[model samples]
Target chain A: MIGRVMDAGPGEPPIWVMRRRATAWTTPQRRYYQLVAALPPLRDFRRTRVLPMSQRRLEERLALLHPEDLADLRMAVSLVSWRRQPINRTTAEIAAMYEECMAATRNRALRSTVEFRMNVRTVMVALRLKRLGRGVPSGRWGVGNYTRTIESRWTDPEFGLAAVFPWIPEARVFLDQGDATGLESLLMGLLWTKLSQVADRHPFGFEQVFAFAFKWDILHRWLSYDAQKARRRFDKLVLEATSEYQDIFA
Target chain B: MESLVLTTGWMGIFSPLALGAIGSMIGVGRGGLAAAGAMLEVEAGYGRFVGVAAMPSSQTIYGIVVMLTLNRPVSVANSPGLFVLGVLTGVALLISALAQGTACAASISASKSKAEVFGISIAPAAVIEGFAVFVFVFALVLAGSIPR
Candidate 1:
């Protein structure tokens, strides 16, 4: 997605809104961003291979990595340096899972500042969940019947989304005929797809949250500093990406 | 073609269809995302890899109980509407299955992204699956029960 970042144009609200969501990442999330930004997809190397790696071969490759490789993967997750010991890439995947969630919840209004800001909060909530390890209690337990033990609480921190987000005054409501359950599922699905786009291209050592956040902040700052001038630049990126994907996905 | 909606929507689920608009709003997984860039698809992918997989099968379970309680006997010969209902519900189940499959795809896709595995492209694959489920459940509910 960042491949086209140099190309995002302010004329297109879609790219601008995405840029906003991209801006809300925590320092760690942005670190992963820069690492991804500074690299391109592994496909550059894959083109040399005649046959694609099989599922088993791929799994073996992932499982085969040594401890150093694990550390390299961690380097991509956040700025903190840990042992270069190898661990499965699966650990970092949880956040990478929901990359393009904002795309799925698309609404004309959400593309606007006020509504998308709500989405940013929701994303932050999700990030908090990412921090909390699974199998822990969210506190509601038997009463509200939470599936996970309150992965991370904010909606009442005392309550849940059931008690909070639904009624938040500033929250922008998107019209979805699907149940809340289905909505969650859809957001997750899209996130994985987008994250995969960036993750697959870049190496494990390069991904980081703080770095990307900084870059996003930089662009955001640039945009804020010179809205008229940056708008021209932003439009260039979007027009170019639109043209690129037109050739690709088209 | 029309059933009574059966039992005031037990557990507040009026089938995936009745809650169609709402399900797309509150659920935790990308089972219903419309495209590859969809939010649910992304979340589901990440959710699965960390073993933080979201709720699955509960809706179907509730759906079954609701079906049995309100439209008992699985009758094929008597109610013409049964056929349509079965077909429709089948579509819903199929859509639900689609969401599940995307979740599965997301699980693997998560690995693909991490391992830098190429060739297997990632897509906001939840929508197509939803379409299937939508059709399958419709068939299931409407099957042999046209409510003559």
Candidate 2:
């Protein structure tokens, strides 16, 4: 989550796509593999990884790569063999880089994946936004940078919730009616925002906040639906905080 | 020697002045000065917790002794006062815990420590502990004045 999307935004030149015989796996494929890895007892889907043709193509392209590494590639991509090295090398270049990189690492390479998106538009937008930052060498005079920061982007914070939107056949169990995506977007986004804020203010994250609240068993009381109760809960929490100050701060 | 202890409605509650004494000797006092220093170091992203943790342990020991001398074999199940005292003891422990936790977080932020990423905050943990102390002190004073 922190790696690719968080730093980049709406306007940047599109990332030049090389279209690897394997350039990079699309975002969906990466997410799919990631989800598959996490969902245990789903071994049936795991067997389809070995692709041999891509393996040979990768081997031919990167002359220094080993055959066992090539065998591993076949298993990773589920390919039969490499009929054309240069013809498919653009995509395979991405694959080869990953395979070579993995072989160097101690971590066992189970899946070969890369950024599915080559968003030149997002790049251009980010660059445009960056351009807004520079008024002079002294880094003075630019009102546009502030505007760029608050500017809304399409693939915003709720991307995770959005991805799960279609798959959730029923809505009632998790959410209250009325545009679950919008609400989930709002709620989860709010939660993510709160989580981020609390994490920022304190030395922890929302998950930790949840655990702390879970320990107290009514963390939701701090922000429950009943406004009065939530307020009282907040008050109690605040008084408690003040008392803590009295303990150390006093 | 004159008794420095104070009374409230005919009950002698532990004094904040005494708190300073107790805290100084056992709970975050001279013994904990090193730890306090360590705690501050954590916010700067360093690991000096050996000393930081020491302060609270000393303070907790003081609480344990203070309550134990006033009451014997303190347990939450048996001694209502001590149970509350135990809560207070837990709170006092958190001052050190807070320092240590913060130091640990700083260390983590600096990539000097591995444990900070979980981000389970110590502030609430300390607050939760403070309630125990408050209840303990209340019970101590209330029990003395009230008749069974």
Candidate 3:
């Protein structure tokens, strides 16, 4: 029904075609393999060479890609490889490396998403390190130029946690109170807010679909952790968002 | 009487209105469904979604204007002018409305969650409206040259 409504004039491209074109610019092959590795059932696999979303599917889908594409694919495989678990990389370092990998894809929306996630992750890790009274390794942040900004503000009392992510100040309160559940919920909410903005800014592109997929993944992980808790948290977040909307619209 | 109606160019008089109605109906219909879907996800801030959904309605207004501009008594002499301008302008409006509807739908869906994007998301629909305006202005300009 939605499809019929969206299909307009003869010249208008179909939604599926738009989706393909939008998503084609991103590292879809790498994303697909990452998803495969993230799946609990598949995580134990030493290699995903035999996975349906892996080599064969990638080759078939991206037959036009040059050798560089294959090289990128190999890099992704190495990153997701089970052996990499033994590496002593910090969360910030891992995130930075992943973001650097995504930057190579040359998709604007994907790059924005990676950069946004990197900033959020960097803040979270810095906060954790601060709470432990450890020094923040400013050099580890993966987002290129922003690393220096993050470093300077790493321990700046006034310009710390809440200042970095102005959109979700509640995150600071949750973190300060040691409310693990609230912090997790707030983090997801903040991420959703960014994803929603991306979807809005690029309505005709793959960002909307990516936002939905990212939300679904977060929700799924939350549910797996504790279904009842996750549901309650989600309902609360929606209520908060709705109330904020009402406040503005009223 | 039928022969008089033909010679008098009733087709020229009604052409814009008929095409306008068809175009607006399809355009609004497309955007309306999207607005409904959007409201399902976020009940608040519905006014903006509805506004975006109504973007295609401008085509109908353009159609009405063209109809009025071409409203001179249809004689064999002026009938061809009316027929060509009215029909072509109507077609342009029709195509523009249909395209605008799709953009409006996308806007509504996107703005449901991110209310801040309501303003920016409407840009694509507004761009589509520009094409409709070009048709409207050109039709009016061309109508001035038509003989009475």
Candidate 4:
């Protein structure tokens, strides 16, 4: 899958293609002033207890996007989303998906945003592999530009890229201590910061919209982890299950 | 060459109105789109959004006044002055209107979410308008000395 993705076609690199397409099609001149203004500001994920905008409302607002942009955004989201991957999907399939997403995304900011998330995922994978005392497997085990560096520098504590990724040491500590929740929180915080910067740099533009959507996703995911809510949902499910059995016995 | 310069003077005299109108059209369009979008999310206070959208319209008025002020006979002497002043004023108004429209759209979008910020959010647009007024006032004052 990695070989297929790398040699998909002969032409410009994906990054260069993305840059050229972005300049030609996704110039900042196309402002969504009304759409942007209509959406509410998203609070930081860590600080947000309740999502300011519901998923339905967000979808409704997103409907205002140009059809092409909406399509691009959907494709990008599917690729970069932190949602659990399907159990059956092979690593090669995931790699192919990432390649497809990068090729199709026309916006530079959006493409780079996806790249950033993928790089983070790659780094996390490397860390996990290291923690497991495993050697870097051949072929594309991860995405982004750092795959080669990670493979070669697998023994380095920070994979010899500590300066590039300042949070590696902290993330390493979390991983070492088996602090899964802490590591997740740190990763989300890093992405949140990146999205915030993107939104700030491109206010009232497509980049801002993409950033908001991703940030909203993060906030929604964080808020759904309430123990009380989970307990209530668990109880409701159990009650429903028991009621079915009761009816059968009756 | 002389005819061309005079013709340029005439073009300059009308440039403000034409350019200012174009700027206002875009500016107002931006603000109006934001206002309309905000209306979907909001229940009341729609009037204020419309009012904010109209902020960019002031540039057109300034353009009209500049056009009138620069409306003197087009001679070689006054042609240069008219051309310089009219074209420059139009450009300024055009840019300011475009910028203010963006500011107004931002204000409307922000204020719609947090009602408290409605008043304060417009400060940036107001500041941009202040700059437009400076261009307007100075253009008028300078028009008096343009070999009219």
On lDDT, the leading prediction is 4
- DockQ for each candidate? 0.01, 0.01, 0.03, 0.77
Q: Number of the top candidate by TM-score?
A: 4
TM-score of chain A of each: 0.22, 0.18, 0.51, 0.84
lDDT of each: 0.35, 0.32, 0.61, 0.86
lDDT of 2: 0.32
Write one digit per residue (lDDT tens) for candidate 4, span A1-250.
Answer: 1333434256756554655555665454568987888788787777777888888999999998998799999998887776667899877887877777877767878888898898898889889888898886577678777887887898898998998999999999999999877888999999899988988898789988989899888777777766557889999999999999999999
Per-residue error at A69 for model 3, in Å?
Answer: 14
Q: TM-score of chain A for candidate 4?
A: 0.84
Model 3 error, position A138 (Å): 5.5
Candidate number with the higher lDDT (1 or 2): 1
- For model 3 chain A, where is the 10-residue window of minimal lDDT? A35-44
Q: In model 4, where do residues sit more than 4 Å from their true spots?
A: A1-28, A227-229, A232-250
lDDT per residue for candidate 1 within A62-142, as digits (tens), equals 343344333333333232111122466432242232223233322222122212222333343443443363333342221
TM-score of each prediction: 0.22, 0.24, 0.45, 0.90
iRMSD for every model? 9.7, 19.2, 13.2, 1.0
Tens-place lDDT digits, model 2, residues B8-93: 21112232224423433443332233333333323543333333323333334444444434443323333444334444444454
Candidates sorted by lDDT, best first: 4, 3, 1, 2
Could you tell me which residue pairs clash in candidate 4? none
* True-vs-predicted CA distance for residue B117, candidate 3, Å: 21
Per-residue lDDT tens digits for candidate 4, residues B1-148, read: 9999999899889989988999999999999999998998889999999999999999999999999989988999889888888999999999999999999998999999789999999999999999999999999999999886
Better of 2 and 3 by DockQ: 3
lDDT of 1 by residue, B59-141 (tens): 35535543553354433343434434543453455455435544433434344245453123233334444554455455545
What are the per-residue Cα lDDT tens digits for candidate 2 across A1-250?
Answer: 0112211245752222222213344322111111111111111111323221232432333232234433443443232111223554443344344334333322121221211111211222233333456221212111112213323331332222334333222332233344533433333233333333433443322222221222121222222234566688999999999999999965
